[model samples]
Target: MNIVLTVLEVTAPVFLLAAVGFIWVKMGFEYRVQFVTRLAMTLSVPCLIFVSLMQTDIAPQALTALSLASIAAYVLVTVLCFVLVLLAKLDRRTYLAPLIMGNTGNLGLPLALFAFGDVGLGYAVVVFAVMAIYSFTFGVWMVSGGGSVIKVVKEPMVGATVLGAIFLWQGWETPRFLTNTLDLIGQIAIPIMLITLGVAVARLHPGRLGRAVWLSVIKAGICAAAAWGVGIWFELDQIALAVLVLQVSTPVAVTSYLLAEKYGADADAVAGLVVISTLLSIITIPVLLIFLM
Candidate 1:
């Protein structure tokens, strides 16, 4: 009961407020939600990355662990995508991105901060940075059927990661004023992401719920299992391993749908997968915490 309450306390407010915002959209305030999401993606999120990386202490060992974990995650997801395609007899384009790109940014980051605090958040940032690069580069390649790799390299998020990496590598100490400014912007990221998720959910089709549910279960289960087994074998620290497993268990990222829509890869299916995985995460995440924490 205490665990349940804790989980609800941490998770519910964000989603509930978003739900209210969704209802407001039903009453004709949709633009507000869009504006917030755009602000977060374009401004707040980059600041969050800059602030977090600039402040966190990055030892060589920690960097090594994070690098290994990131590679593990990428390899696991790639193999899973292949198996899923073969086993489910899915077309290459249908489930590729949605299957590989879990929701590591919006949902995973917040949950890592909540569960493991600063250390978890730092580790998540490392993982997220690597995953972001892979998703933008290799993911686009796969989805675009070997289209211009140069175009993928030029994505704004790719540039953001590169900029953040330079800051991290230099071990730049952000001035107090700058850190404070970035922190203020960073604080808006979580709420904006949640509200965006809620608004997206509000547009979901009830008729597609069954398929969404199945995809969510598969995504959460397989991802968690892969993370757990690999993490244990790799001897990752408790908190790092926990963060990795929880991140992997998250639903398909919202970006999956965007990419699918852009690349013509079953956008509806990707959207449904995102919604389903996110909703089901309310259950899977807590259970995962029980094991990981």
Candidate 2:
């Protein structure tokens, strides 16, 4: 009973903020998604990652282990999702990326902070960075039928991750004033992301919801199972392991739908995935937190 309350306490704000965005959009408010997304991803999120990594007390070795573990977990998820997509006879271009990637940035980060505190956020950022790079490069290519490594290199988050890792490695800190400024900017990231998620969902027109439902269930199972197995194999500690599983198993990201729309690969189908998987996470996330906690 205590655990249930704790889980709800942690999750309620995250989902509620998203709901606020949803309601706002439905009510016909002006919410600029492109601006907000760019601000969060390019500026706020990178600041959050940099500050968290710089401030984390997790041992350097542990951070390294978590990074490797995250890479392994994603690789495993890719393989499993690929096989599942093939078996289900889903269009590889549309279905494959959504199945493999997740809403790690928006949902996973905040959940980690609330569930496991600062240490979990530190670990969560690593997984987010890995996923960002992978998604920008290979995942984009998969959807558009072409990808560029240079695009990955130019991403702000990538630079932030690399810089953060270096700072962590060297046990370095910026000036206190500068650090505080970055922290302040970083603070808005979670709420912005959550609200943005709600807005996107509110705006999306889902297609093939029946298929989306079943596939979402399958995605939850396979993602959790694969991430768990990989975490155990890598021998990550409790927080790292749990963070990896939660991040990997998050709902299909809205970005996947946008990509499909841009690349001409069944946008409505991807929207179905985004909506259904996110709805499914409302239940699945709390269940996982109960266990993780």
Candidate 3:
């Protein structure tokens, strides 16, 4: 009973903030999604990642273990999803990327912080970084048939991740004032991301929702199972294991839809995956938290 309350306590704010965005959009408010997304990705999210990694108390060794575990888990998910897409006779360009990439940033980060505190956020950052890079490069390539390594290199988040990892390894810290400023900026990332998620979903026009529903179910299962198996094999500690599973099992990201729209690969279908997967996460996330907790 207490666990149920705890799970709800952790998740309510996330969905509620998202609901705020949804309602705002429904009420016809001015919410500039492109500007908001750019701000979060280019500035706030990188700060969050760097600060979290810099201030984390988790051992460097444990973080490295989790990083490798994350890469392995994603690899497994990709293979499984590829097979699923092929067998289902779905358009690879439209379905595969959404199946592989999850909303680790908006939903997963907040859930980790609420569920397991600072340590969990730190661990979640590592997984998010891995997924972000992979999504930027390989995931993009899958959809567009051509990904630029230079584009990946230019991403602010990737730069932040590399710098943060270096700092963590070297046990370095910035000046206190700078740290506080970055922390303040980083604080906005969670709420901004959550609200932005709602806005994006509200604004999207999804198609093939029936197909998306079943695919979302399959994605959640595959991601959670893959992460769980890899986490155990890698002997990640309790928090690390939980965070990995949660991050990897998050709903399909809105970015996947954006990428599809940009690259002209069934944007409506990808949007369906994003919306349905996100809605499905409301139930799936709490259930996983209950088990993980």
Error of 3 at 203 (Å): 0.5
Clash total of candidate 2: 0
Model 2: pairs clashing at backbone N, Cα or C within 3 Å: none
- How many angstroms is residue 213 displaced in model 2 relative to the true structure, after the best TM-score fit? 0.4
lDDT of 2: 0.95
Residues 1-293 of candidate 2 have per-residue lDDT tens digits of 99999999999999999999999999999999999999998999999999999999999899889888888888888998899988989899999999999999999999999999999999999999999988998899989988889999998889999999999999999999999999999999999999999999999999999999999999999999989998999899999999999999999999999999999999999999999999999999999999888
lDDT of 2 at 278: 98
TM-scores of the models, in the given order? 0.88, 0.99, 0.99
Cα lDDT for residue 113, candidate 1 = 81
* Model 2 stretches with alpha carbons more than 4 Å out: none
Error of 3 at 190 (Å): 0.4
- Model 2 per-residue lDDT at 185: 95
lDDT of 3 by residue, 79-153 (tens): 999999999999999999999999999889999999999999999999999999899889999999987889889
Q: lDDT (CA) for every model shown? A: 0.74, 0.95, 0.95
Report the number of the highest-lDDT candidate. Answer: 3
Indicate the residue-level lDDT of 131 in model 1. 71
Prediction RMSDs, each to the true structure: 2.5, 0.6, 0.7
